[model samples]
Target: MRIGLYATGQAGLEGIVEDIAAAERLGLDSAFLPQLTAWDALTVAALAGPRVPRIGLGTAVVRTYAQHPLALAGQALTAQAATGGRLTLGIGPSHREIVEGGYGLSYDRPARHVREYLQALRPLLRGESTDFRGETLSVSGTVDVPGAEPPPVLVSALGPVLLGIAGELADGTVTVWAGPEVLGEYVVPKITDAAKRAGRPAPRVVASAMLSVTADPDRVRADIRGRFGTAGEFASYRRLLRQQGKAGLEDTVAAGDEDFVAATVARFAAAGVTDLLVSPVGTDEERERTLAFAARLR
Candidate 1:
């Protein structure tokens, strides 16, 4: 499995570019920038592309509620060209709270919205025009980006319905808060079966987790809980945690010494993960230790 870093992009543009460059220096496969409240991930990737030449640049997820499919396709293709085709476009229908409360957009029938979004998006990414009409969206356009190949699209899917949709429509699924048990027993089989039914290739399983190589594992876990406890409360994440028999987000973390962390990562690889994105959590020294250990795994 390819191992990479999950960048929060809290660091400004230059910091983010430096982070990607450092990830490349460490031999990580990719640097996935999240679309949080800070800098725009696609724009950061486009700007960082020319700086960090080898490492892959991806959006852990860009919300689809606010942006139209046609518009996003153009931006993704432009980034793809700028990054020399080292871009993976990961998009999703964000949580209902975030969509309705934050974006002031309707979150009705997210599955249908994603279905319609992909139906129109896939064709445009391939430089083909799409004249489709669906309940949630209607699009008739094509995106043209010379010297840019279509980047693989992955959906941030957790539940069975969205997993099926991702399998049939997307290149893979990007999962967070799912442990090896959930991936092996639930996620991998569900998506793989759906892909087989759709006659698509094996789907990429990109698992994101908080990990640290620290002596005080308990402290790191507590810190993680303090920071990310609310994430476990999210409907989708709560469901995933339940599937894994985990109490909260901290329960999903892989923290300990080198041997323990390595064994945890091995479990993910054995569970059929195609890529593992490590979100290191700890003091600066411990985070660096975690990154160095993760690079050794590569």
Candidate 2:
């Protein structure tokens, strides 16, 4: 497994920056930056880029409702240049609450929007002018991005339809809260089937989630509950988890021991996950434990 860490939502960018060097030193593969209220993904990527050497960088899921696809492609390509080409842009049309309620953006026809976005975005990244029209978007101008290499796009696809879309159009797919066992039985088959049908080369799958471990597993679970508390109180989170048979295990992070954590991560790799993202609680002791566990894996 290519093990890495999630920038704990509770940890500010500065805290994540503080941890990056240690993360790389411990030989964890990379760190995933999440887009949230207090932080922006691009800024975080820039600040942390020069600080960590050769450590992979990614956005767990940047909300697509905030910008046009062409614009997003330009931004990511520019950032990749700044990072000497070490950025992965993971994107999706975020949920209704953030898109509709928070951003006042329409959530209708999201899958169509994503398809349109990718169509325009891909050609633009390859230094070609684009004039494409789709149900959700239309662009008729040059969108050349100099010094921007083709960064692998990992789509946030949890269901069959989107998984098929990812296989057809993107380089990879990312899943969170979808356990590895579930992946083997469900997610992988859909993506592989789609890829085979499309005659595309094999695509990558990156799976991630919260997993806790400590001398006191109870305390670790409590920490997970506290960190993901907001997720628990929501109907959306419940529905998202239930959609994958993970509703009750939203607290899996809270109950896991080191063995549990390791086993969960191992399951993801065994299930063909190219990247396994681990969200450790944002505590010094917890971080230390995670690093130690990661070192043992190394």
Top candidate, metric TM-score:
1
Tens-digit lDDT track of model 1 for 147-232: 89999999999889999999999999998888888898889999999999999999999999888998999999999899889877
Clashing pairs in 2: 221-254
Clashes of each: 0, 1
> Where is model 1 more than 4 Å wrong at Cα?
none
Clashes of 1: 0
What C-alpha lDDT do the candidate models reach, one value each?
0.91, 0.74
Q: What residue runs in model 2 are displaced by over 4 Å at the alpha carbon?
A: 229-240
Clashes of 2: 1
The candidate scoring highest on lDDT is: 1
Candidate 2 on 239-285: residue-level lDDT in tens? 65676665454454533467776776677778988888777653567
